[model samples]
Target chain A: MLKENKKELESDVIQLVPQLTLDCVIFGFHDSSLKVLLLKWKGTEFYSLAGGTVRQSESLDKAAERVLMERTGLDKIFLRQFHTFGNVERYDREKIKKMLAHLIDPDLWYERAISVGYYALVDYMKVFPNPDALSDACEWWDLNEVPALLFDHEEILEKALHALRLELSFQPIGLNLLPEKFTMPDMMRMYEAILNKKIDPRNFQKKILKSGIVIKLNEVKRGVAHKSPFLYKFDPEKYEEVLREGGLFFI
Target chain B: MLKENKKELESDVIQLVPQLTLDCVIFGFHDSSLKVLLLKWKGTEFYSLAGGTVRQSESLDKAAERVLMERTGLDKIFLRQFHTFGNVERYDREKIKKMLAHLIDPDLWYERAISVGYYALVDYMKVFPNPDALSDACEWWDLNEVPALLFDHEEILEKALHALRLELSFQPIGLNLLPEKFTMPDMMRMYEAILNKKIDPRNFQKKILKSGIVIKLNEVKRGVAHKSPFLYKFDPEKYEEVLREGGLFFI
Candidate 1:
């Protein structure tokens, strides 16, 4: 696998854009916690976001989708281009050499590159992680527990989380991160996890209910001590309309 | 001037990242209308937004700011990156050749490129437009009267405007487009121009007042015939705080 990847990299360098790349901060929600998928570099302890270079034949967005699919095996998820990181200091030559090491030729690497950062929201249980050619393992790490990342990935991940939280104010993002049917507390918990702060449960419930994008189901979520909260699911039409018209105010 | 510009371009090409560029949609509100700053290409009837390439030495944002300053002569204005356009069809070889006709070398031109789109808001009266080397003139155009632009610049402008409208819901953008002291009617008019829709004056006033980012002054404008409206100005500290904390909801 290593030899094939090195050969492919040597030849494909001409086909790929030398100074442009895309990185994904894939976030998942499970076990009442917010998590991010990270890749463990081959023969190194450093972890980084799943990312790859753009091919000359593909669009930037297509490249991002390809990266997400290659690492998570999940297609058609809610992937958003949040921000592009192009600080000159982000490209440390020594760091790049250490990260790529034996996988790529030293001469093929460019000294400076710009990364377009994207963030994806996926269901935790559905994703089966797959490492790319240069990585040995792919897995989920709780947001706080994530190890030191390669390059400026730590900054990229922070900005992605910030973008997600800001998006919650005016978009129905819960639909992408939460299950099809969830209790009000469950929804609140997901919001709490993303925001990384405590939200007033009553305030959150009131806002979500007033938005009219979610529908209250007759069935209840069982097995919570003595209380069984009513389960609710998104009204797909209303959710679509709200997303189109842009005024959900879900925070 | 043309020879000097050509020489500069020839020398600067190697300094810029060949496949990446930045474009700006500079929006200004005046005369009860929204205006965009556009450049008329040298010796051609085409217009395009103020834009430039990312230098290897500078970051993406620095490149955008440089482009904005070179054209508008205004520094430290509200510049926000809205989107990055990288569609395969955005690059039309014949179209680009026509646009750059006599300016650039055919061999140096790239077949495919990506553009980072940015939008800026500035006081209409403050900007003194200056054309770049490839452009003959830079001037303001009413949003409705924008001419057929070069490349996919029309799409880029539309996306920037959409992003600006979306940002209005969460940020206090009036501070950038309006004067230090303005009336409620003036504020409402600017909003209407950007949103391209009439908002009920009462509802708009109510929301703005409740946001607590603007302060009412004791003096009223005396120029009006019958009834004079009180003036208001932004509470700068509060506005900055709201921007930092991220929950202004200004519609």
Candidate 2:
């Protein structure tokens, strides 16, 4: 394992895109709460989004997918590149420098560091988070309760959340966060959770139904405090068509 | 002048962001056609988007502004980061290597090169396009008729156009492209050019009016074949409010 880990960090890695890193902010919705997958470094109190150096021969998109799969053991997910953070100071602060000293020379790292932030919206319950060799534990942190993250990761996470919220306002990305089949109320709860606000139930229902991207499933909520809501599933074909036609317009 | 240029390339230039570059896709609406800023390499048939290497200390946004000002002699333009091109092959082709050999060691350049793509919507007549030290000319090529561009610039241009068109469909970014006081027909023409499709004048007028983002300027077109259309300007306060609320909702 020690040899394997050292080989992974070797300089002769084919087509390695040096001084470049990829960070994934995997957002998931579970138990009516919005959460993000985070990894804590081994034997340290510091935490960060799963990050990987880009391989030289791979496109940023492919690199992002590789990193996501390596960290969470999940693939074929839609990973959106929200922003590339290029502030040279991102790894220059003394505390962050100390946190990263073992992994990279802070002086050289700060000289050429730029990170592309990619985000994935996944069903939290389905994902099996796996930490990389450097970290021992990976878990989901509630969007509202993330701890102090290492380096410039907290800012990256904030921007990822902002990008996700902006897209959710219009794009039907909840398909990535929700289960295959869920009650309409569950769908509504997820949206409310992401938006961090309560929406008018009647208006929300009417708008979604009018959008025609969701199909009524032949099921209902089995156990609930209130009357069970009708089950719904996203119509992939209609969803793509609607998304192409500027997505679901949320007013 | 040669000595001055040599000194500019020296390593002593403070705060240079090594291995990182900024490329701008300056989109301008002109003669009812959407266009982009392109720079032709000096003594070569090759053309590329105006690009600049990043200085180490300044933020990416500031570097983008600096590059835009150096290329177009325009300042205070709102340039949006659309994508980051980190493909190792972005400058790996033989022809591109030769074209850029004098500027960078192609081997080293290919190893760590990553470019941040930015797009700006500016009035066509407002910019005075200027070539950099390596280019002989800078001009706007019609988005439909752009010649073969150098490096992966063509891909960058396409993505920028796609981003611009997508945002134009919903966002009131026309605030940047249109003159302060313009007629309804002028605004409609700009939209038609961007969408590459004719819009029904009546429906377009109705929608813009309903958005409540533009304020009538109490003026009319001076001379036109049709009856002079009412002139208007984006209502600053209302425009900001609408933009903050996620811009015009064009269905």
Candidate 3:
């Protein structure tokens, strides 16, 4: 029954007068770095942001989640709808025409397609990157080291980054990026990675500590350095309460 | 050439997939009351939110501007994209199918669709409401007396109102809502309407006056019961700066 309904919906979509697609800018923090999940085309050097079309029966949010899950074996991550890019030039008409001339038939090329862009933050170690049949491989590229991506994906990524920065100013973000248990230095490094700027270590620690969102565990980093930093974990219930109360601090 | 391109795009969409549409919730302030723009259906008791389909060659933002202009005959208003709702059940599929079966043909009933919602704040008096072909009349309804709207519009309006409340809390919002020259009471009333609660008159004045975002006019309101309140207007540039600096106070 589900399959039949899916087929019916697809046929309905084909009969409609406009097309909708979903694009994702998946960001991850690792090794004191901010990286974006990108896919390289199967037979060409062309790379692009991970994306896919929405099934006729699927909600736009479901499409984004499915795209992320397909491209990278991760689920239940922090995903958000950032912006919908609808400029006619967004598809690069000329380039699309050229690509379609060789790839898809010209008859299928003129379809009016609009895409919604969503951004997701995932734990780097938790995701197993899987390249789809259309792509050569999926890999995490340091945001600063991003190669030229196909279409307007670069612009979409930039917009996603701007949204992430804005969110960071008021939200507690590193929890999704760091391991369940980590040292203060580890958390600080993740912040530095996401903010993409050098922050005073002492000031960063003071602000975060004063926020009272992180709880220090009776543990410390093993080995290395003259003094082992204390480990900490986020208190979800308190953090959410702070978020709701509009008392979350951002600098 | 543009017309031909449009036709070709439309045909292509008919052969591809359905595209998401956009609906705008434009709220305005006037007569010491909050108002939202609405369009009444021509032959039925149904009322629809201001809406338009996303053109193949247009962005969502552009589509919103077009819809706003066409519905209200107003341009260059303060507009912002708030959120997009894509619940699978957003449309009453059963109702649509039944309507099409009775009114048109079943073949024409099958179409996949989703809608993105945007909210804008405008000056109510500046707009000339012009109902479209499908609509009987266009008018501003007081927020307190909104009629039952079609589809999931009431929910959409609620979401937009929530976002507006948050904006009022953190941002200086009266520049678009109030006239070029207005009194302090005008600003306070607008705030009270958005906050939906009575604020201490003296405390509100003290806080706003100290913010330095409003400039006192050498004028005052005329024909009042008691002492005429002093007139004041907001400084757009300075208010924007304060917004950026996150200096707006909210409790």
Candidate 4:
């Protein structure tokens, strides 16, 4: 069955658009740190974001969505195309040939291919990482511990993070990375993780309340040894309204 | 010479990457209105942004730079890749076939092509718009007066403009769309044009002055019937430092 699948993969390559691909940087938050989804290549030290090719009949966005679903077992999340990497130097023909020798024809069309970079924000607790055919393991890695990636993926990852950070500066996008019910401290920690720095606790709370995207709920969080903190869920209508009226950020 | 060049173009198409292209929305500001550069197809009322195909040896950024230089006769400006458009519905086979029937073979490889969108901020006075081989004229059109564009270009243009506006909401990008020396009123008008609304004059002055991206000059305007406004220029070092520090916007 493996042999037959490999043979079918060679024939299926013809249906993909030549010289165009998509790579997704899936970001999730957990344990007070921003994490990124990565896949470990089978029997190799290399890791990379889940990527796929665009089919002749599908849109680029759909291809990215399909790739995200195949790897994380999650869909309908916040995904955005941040940038496209197409430097001639990014195509290391000999290295790629060696890396995929067991999987692909190797003579396959990988010369100067362009990859559109997309960044996705998913709930940490909901994701179930699944490896692709060429990878042995797929899981979340803290941003600080991310190893050197394959191809131009490291640069792509940096750019994706930078774009996400820039958006966070003016927009309340941290809500996407947190659970529906979270504390103000949870929100501030999410922002600090993405920004890679510390923000004033007093300032964050004051400004966030003034922004009015979050509301104070009547219930407190359960299962806490210390004094339980108040639980808060995003006011969806207020959040959407603030987004439309030129977003206000606390950080 | 024209016939020979046409013959060369037919074979040269093979050098271009199949199913990938680029379109640039070159924006300029003049006379209190925001303008976009467009090309009118030869002997037809159809209009489109200056665009080109990527070559096998070049990066996407390099391809966009080449296309921008070809049309605007200007280089070293602020150019950015904003988004990539790849909808299956965007490809109108019959329309493109009829439009380029005189230029290329009927069986060209344009089925479901993906176009990377770029937006350029250029000085209005520096541009020398030149028509491409298939275009009769290239000129600037006011954003309000832009005609129905060819292909999915209208949607692409709108997206580029929206991206620029979103950036403006968080960053002081208006400097790129203005001249080297300008007055406070001139800067305010530039902002109003791009935002497509009026900003309170006193509030704009107070916020922009506090932002410190611009330096007030001692000299006043030379030609004016009423009181002449003082001229000012951007402080490059301060502007760049603010950008590096995640930008401070007045709008």
Candidate 5:
């Protein structure tokens, strides 16, 4: 089965667009810090974002969506293309050839490479990552503790974060990284995680009330020390409209 | 000389990255409308943005800047890559083959293509358009009067304009499309052109004054049918800083 799979992979690789790859920077809010989805390559010290080469018939955006779904079981989330990484020496071609010597032709592997970077904000609890043959593990890594990435992925991630931050200051996008029926405090945490700065709770509540992106649910939480904050869910129609024409940011 | 230039172009075409092109959407503000730079292909009824194939060694961004300079005779403009067009049939293969059959191998000319779109705002008076071999002329067209483009350029231009509008609402970037010295009325006109709506002059003046991106020049303009408006220049140091850090838009 493995041999047959490898043969199919080789055929697909031959059909793939040469020297181009699609790397996804998937950001999710979990615990306190904003986290990114990363894959640990099998039998290697390097890790990378959920990424793959473009197929012959599909667009780069489609390839990115396919890769994100294959790695993290995510679908229907909008992945925004932030930038393309095309530095001549972004990746060590010789080192990549050495690493994939058993799997691919070194000459083919060493072609001057370029990759487009796409990013999406997904709810941390919803995504269940499943690594493929190239990697042994897929997990969320805290942005602060992100270990050394394989190539210029670290730079790509940095740019993605910067784009996200700029949007956060103007658009209501942090909700995508929060679960439905979340408390105001969790939403605040998500904003803080993306902004990397503390947002006053009162200020956030006031701004959110004016933004009209959130709908207050009738039910309140029971598990709390003093009082339970009312749960809220995003108004899908309003959110989609705002997503197209951005809303005022809480900041 | 024409044949020799054609031969050199063929060589450069051979050195280009397979199936990938770079198209630039150069925007300028003149009179009262937002304008875009476009090229007229020699034989076709269609026109398109100033665009070219990417050389094998240079990055896509570098290729875009080169195309911009070669076409407009302007340099030092920083273009931002807004999107990539990668539909399988983005450009008609049969049409391309018929167009380039005499110059290139039809097999090579008809490869499935993708394009990266870059946009820049430049002063209209500073740009001197130059047409290359494949094109008969290059000119700035009002955004409303843009003719039917050769391929997906129409779509690409639309996306670029959308990005510029989004940026215009938050970033003080429209100054690049203006003359170095201009009246407050012209500045307001630039915003109206970009935002595609009339702005309250009083409000715009209030915002620009508070933003401190513009300097009150010692000289004032003597114009007919109106009181003399002060000539203003961008505070180079502060404008550069706002450009780097993005100033508040005069929306």
Candidate 6:
């Protein structure tokens, strides 16, 4: 019954002008550091986040996946829609009018585009990202070292970071950043990196241990400390359940 | 600087299909009731919530306001965008493709239309609704009495209700539903209506009092069989601050 309606909607979308695009805020943790994926635009000093337009035949989710694959070379990862950016001034139409007064045709200069923001958490080591035709370089920037970004991209990145922090408050995240089995210090470092704060070591361990989401492994760290920290692995099943129940683990 | 980009985006949208619709889930509280504004389509048995298409040169938010005003004769009420219903199946094209196969051209039937969902909170008694050209009647249905709605409207309403409930948990809402000054019972009834459950009277009162977002009016209800409940009014400044801080108050 719903299939027929879907077909009609697909046909309708094909007939309309393609004004929608998907902008991704891809976050990755590496070397106990928080980073975001960005593309340095070719021929310009500006860098932008990895993003692309939605195809007529694709769902918004599919479009986001396509963008992720094309930009990051990652086939599948954890990606979710966070919000849509649609303020009238978001596109900054007034400035465009003056800049393109003579260089570009006026008719082609002003095009209204609304973008859906998608945030993805991925294993940084697994993906090999390549810049598209319009970009010079595609790379990960430490959250603290972000350069000037184009088209409200900075604002978009900030929103994604805020959402990620909130998600961390409840979910057992940053697992993507670690190996299958990791030490407590490794996990704590990831938290400290993303939070950009020095947490009390004793208190942090106590809070996380009480949450019961993490399971301690008999294996210990291999090197570099007076006493090796115990290895831990996140229980995905329990982590998901807690997320579904809207539970939060305070730091 | 951003204005030029916005102009380009706007022009791009115009090149797309012409139909841009605004659908609203207008919620009202009456007689300890929680209700939603809905409409009956003119030629079909399918009932729907109040909605309409946007005119050329009109902003999406303005389109929502216009649709709200045209249907309910209410202005300056609190309205917010919850989600954009742009799934390819939004229009039920396959049914239309089969049902109007002979009468309507397939090209016309597939014309893309994007509808934005906005939920509004208004005083039920203040509205004087008149159905639009596509609808037979405009009416309010108790939240519990919602029938099968047309298109993806049921899903839209569910999402809106979820957002509303989340909003209620953090903010002292439903001020628009009450008179200038209302008794504690009136406030409690509204809370129960939105929460959709019987709450312990003592606990509910205690929780609300502790939040300190509401002010006691000193006046009391006059025409009740039991002792008159003290009147209360929401402190707008405090309520705003609570909402800003993401404060939670559970009943």
> In lDDT terms, which candidate is top?
1
List-wise, what DockQ does each model earn? 0.65, 0.56, 0.41, 0.78, 0.54, 0.19
Clashing pairs in 2: A15-A56, A16-A56, A17-A56, B15-B55, B15-B56, B16-B55, B16-B56, B17-B54, B17-B55, B17-B56
Model 3: per-residue Cα lDDT over A1-251, one tens digit each: 12224465456743323356678999998888999998987667778899877665677788889989998788888898987776766756677555534433445543456678899999999889888656778999999999998878988998898777766756677767889988878887887787787778888788888877789899888895768878899988867766655544444
Question: Model 5, residue B100: displacement in angstroms?
Answer: 7.9
Q: Order the candidates by DockQ, highest first.
A: 4, 1, 2, 5, 3, 6
* Residue-wise C-alpha lDDT for candidate 4, range B1-251, written one tens digit per residue: 13336456567754777788899999999999999999998778889999988888888999999999999988887888999998887857787767766654556545678899999999899999999877899999999999989888999999998888877766666666788889899999988998898999999888778878899999999898879999989988877877766566655
Could you give candidate 5's per-residue lDDT for residues B60-164 as a string of tens digits? 878888998898888888588888777677767787567645544554443466778899888888999988767778989999999888777888998998888
Clashing pairs in 5: none
List ranges where model 3 is wrong by over 4 Å.
Answer: A1-18, A96-107, A198-213, A224-226, A240-247, B1-19, B96-110, B167-172, B197-230, B234-251
In the range B1-251, model 2's lDDT, one tens digit per residue, is 12344456564655455567888999898887888899988778889998987776677888899999998788888689989987766755777667666664555433456889999888788899999987889998998899998888988988887777766766776877888888888888898888888989889888888888899977887778888888899987877786666656543
State the lDDT at B26 in candidate 2: 92
- Deviating ranges (above 4 Å) for candidate 6: A1-17, A31-33, A94-110, A165-179, A182-213, A222-227, A249-251, B1-20, B54-56, B96-107, B198-203, B249-251
What is the per-residue lDDT of model 1 for residues A1-251, given as tens digits with 9 covering 90 to 100? 24556576667654877688899999999988999999998888879999888888898889999998888888998989988888887947876775575776666666688899999999998899999978899999999899989888999999999888877778887777889999999998998899888989998888889888899999999889868999999998998888877786755
Candidate 6 lDDT, A129-195, residue by residue in tens = 7887667799999999999887879899988887666557656675567777877788888888877
Residues A1-251, candidate 5: write the lDDT tens digits.
13335567666654777667788999888897899999887777778888887877988888888888897788878578888776667877687667756545555443476788899888778899888667789989999999998767888899998888777766667556777788898788888888888999998898887778899999897888878889989887777777778757554
Model 6, C-alpha of A176: deviation from truth (Å) = 4.0
Residue range B166-187, candidate 3, lDDT tens digits: 6676567877788888877778
lDDT of each residue in B93-173, candidate 6, tens digit only: 777455443433455443455567888988999988788765678888999999998767898899888767756765667
Docking class of 2: medium
Q: Measured by TM-score, how close is model 3 to the native structure? A: 0.82
| CA lDDT for candidate 3 | 0.76
**Candidate 5: stretches off by over 4 Å:** A1-14, A91-105, B1-14, B91-106
After superposition, candidate 1 runs with Cα above 4 Å error: A1-7, A10-14, A95-107, B1-14, B99-107, B206-212, B215-218
lDDT of 5 at B127: 90
What lDDT is reached at residue B156 by model 2?
93
Per-residue C-alpha lDDT of model 2 across residues A1-251, encoded as one tens digit per residue: 12344555555645456567888999899989999998988778889899987766678889999988887778888789999987767764777667766664555443456789999988788798998877878999998899988878989998897787777767776777888888777888998888888988889888888888899988887788888888899999888886666566663
Ranking by lDDT: 1, 4, 2, 5, 3, 6
